[model samples]
Target: MTRGDDYVLGRGLADSVRLDAQHLLWKMHKGYELHPLIPRTDNMKIAEIGTGTGIWLFDIARQLPSSVQLHGFDISDNQYPSKELWPKNVSLGLLNSLIDPPAHLVGQYDVVHLRMWVPNIRGNDTSALIQHVKSLLKPGGYIQWEDADLVHQYVKGPKAQEFERRINKIFDKAGLDFRWVSDIPDRLTEKGFLVLESESGRFELDSIQECTKTYLLVLREYINGFKKLPDLDIQQMAKEEEIALDQLYLQYSHGIVYNWSPVSLLGRRDD
Candidate 1:
């Protein structure tokens, strides 16, 4: 299993800021934090896996009743805000959702949420992750997963397309397979979670320019961290990627934007 730190992005202030910005972009695109299909109940418990910076929980805290228990868990707590800064109903902790959850936490949540976890998946398999997340849910609990459909990512302009291609190539060389994103529904069903449905959207024209700018900054950070690997070929590719990213960033103002297929799935644990 790959540790969270082994992934490309760094756990720093800049990365946290980028994550918050990226979260907003996703919220704008998806039009909701929690899926509308998820029926809320009084004093329900919600847990977010891979909850970087605890931003999503904070946002949901305002939208839901204060009695709703909102918990954020990640493999690493480096990016978590101070406890004093958290919302009254929000709490942060460290738990690797890829592994079997602790006995105490098993069957404890009414809802389990995960987002942007494509990199954490290894061997193109999600069975273990799904099983573990399922253990955290009570019968009839909902799991909402949000991930980018990178395998089918599109771009409007030629430069943007080339930029995206290079990014994909780098991801391939780095041994990342995001194909599992498109398999979420099937996988959820196989793991005993009834597929409620999935929602997909891209950054529309009005938000494209701003979203692209934020995405480029985050991509640059990914490249910067990836360059630290000892592999020479990856180092060289990362260098070229930096130049490509800069060129692509310049073209965003010219109405060039990469079409990110953000997919969100909501499923219920079979009783």
Candidate 2:
């Protein structure tokens, strides 16, 4: 599909965007110690949900033994050139988790993985999503879910905490749930899967000014939706709040400060 202007994938960007995404992915992998998910055997099947930019799946296909099969699923159809460079074991497909599973994918994966789906999950009934994921897994297969809490619950600095609170309130006003991390484990357990492991960790960036910039740019499109709230002067306040957020980034650009505290929940389907 054509990369339209409104497309949200981190595509058609300056090099810094790519660098930041890679750095974040590397940090995520390190935080999770991801290697154990792959068994010693050469042949394996893995599925990655919300695989934006397709870089992480490509990296896995490159590093794993050639016999492994890596499939990337995203709502967008912007094919990656990196997939052409990989061995034939890699494939990309469209899998919108909010919709019913495609007929062919039902009960056909060894591992199902997802990352950075916080905003999207907020609009979803996660219990339903978990049940859908459970159906896709082969008996005894695993799932690795990683997402930022982004709710300021574990953030340290005062400025960063305030920024997170504003962002959280904005999302809340927009009717998005910012509490997915606190709720996902319970949803998984209720879906009849065995929670193999669940843990959370925090990372503070030298500056998340760039990250905030991207957020404000996107938030501009939705702020109008909040205009009708009686107590909230969203129309008058949005621009001022956005400007203040931008200024905060400017102050921290030599280092914009931000924190990412994500919860990693791993589960296995009953055999």
Candidate 3:
């Protein structure tokens, strides 16, 4: 696979990783809960940063009783749905978070929600991005962030731990902090948000076999991204890891469970 194709595959795999039963329960109970509290009115303006597939935005709009105005911003246009299925209240905008918010969007939203932004946040100067998010929020508005503490993957098992360590080390070497989720709430607070709530959940399966097939497909794509490296030892190790991951997938297909952990941080922009 080419680099672009590999990247697309990685994104697709990550998105396909479903929120299991427990997550569905929380999502249902929470009304797709927003941190710092849900907006009091359906007419509130909402902005979703890095809306993966626009599914969440569409669902939220469908749930609201009033005419909610929604905007989704992403670097990739891939997240948008077909025009025929688009909601009347929703619009899609191309945005590069590393840069300033577009002139049209400044101080325009009531809720600014950002999820799974770890990759971009780690790749760029997050302080600037945080400030940009802040600027986009209206006074007393809220910003919710959902990300994972990837380093916690190390605690899952020997193989998983090693994988987590290696991935994080690579990210660190690339000037990205893979563990940024652990500090995001505090960072938001420092950025002037009143942290209302922060919680984390873990997903543990009986074995990697439980989720191996799905996981391997993802791994194959991710590995492709690094296949161009010149280091012989690294390439050899990656090959071995790929084999192991594939084996785990086989086991999962038979009936095994894999564990994952994700976190949610919600806060309000102080008036």
Candidate 4:
């Protein structure tokens, strides 16, 4: 089956828009594209796995020198930008990072980046997938990863908390586990990578109303995407989640939003 076939979230225009918006929101929250601790040199190569829309690379490109090569690989290229639109140094291709990278790409990049792969991580075990990513990195290369800390998601009232629980249940049905994001540093350390820094920040709705709404819209899109899946039970679960979210919104007419923390870490391959 194609990589897209295994993806629970449907690939569509709305999904693309969500990815792009989510990228900006994350950048705003984190305050930097590439971590400041990650040293940059001339002619450096960077790769972002599961690069939806290649938006992160495009944004990072503006901050780096034109000579720095940026590569984006995704399972599906449905959201990739057209030729001539992205930076000349930015190249995008199809490669499922969960699998062993091609020999030509082995130990090729100076740095590898991944974001929001929680759903894509099939099992609780990440050893094989971590090895796959390590194979793509050169000795002493860095891996910068960012993902939501859903395990610590919180809401104000009991109703809001119920909404969070129902949303998590949908994630569980989809075979997604947010707990893995918390273990990234340990996983990297086990693979002979030095865990340099691991940090997290909350997506506070009180601070940026627009960003908060965008995040909710992204979650709703996931529920909507589930409806498009081939499985009937999952579709029914999505229907229930949709109704729950709507009821929560109605109950709290002013606003009802859950806070999710995002974790980002920098690790380096031990030479």
RMSD of each: 1.7, 4.9, 4.6, 2.5
Which of the numbered candidates is closest to the native, going by highest lDDT? 1
Error (Å) of candidate 3 at residue 101 is 0.3
Q: On a 0 to 100 scale, what is the lDDT of residue 235 in model 3?
A: 61
lDDT of 4 by residue, 84-136 (tens): 89899999998877667889999999999998876676667777667877998
Q: Give lDDT: candidate 2, residue 214.
A: 42
Query: For model 3, how does the per-residue alpha-carbon lDDT over 90-155 read when each residue is reduced to its tens digit?
Result: 888777765678778899988888765654553434677678888899988888777645556414
Candidate 1 structure quality by residue, lDDT tens digits, 127-243: 878998899999999999888777876577887787787888888888888898988999998889898887776767656766777777768887997789898898889999898
Write down the TM-score for model 2.
Answer: 0.77
Q: Candidate 4: misplaced stretches above 4 Å?
A: 1-5, 204-211, 228-231, 247-253
Ranking 1 against 3 by lDDT, winner:
1
Candidate 2 lDDT, tens digit per residue, 9-104? 233443225534643554544553344753545777888766666667766666678888888787765545555675588788776776567878
lDDT of 1 at 250: 77
- TM-score for each model: 0.94, 0.77, 0.78, 0.90
- Give each model's whole-structure lDDT: 0.84, 0.62, 0.62, 0.80
lDDT of residue 239 for candidate 2: 51
**Order of models, best TM-score first:** 1, 4, 3, 2
**How far does residue 263 in candidate 3 sit from its true spot (Å)?**
1.3
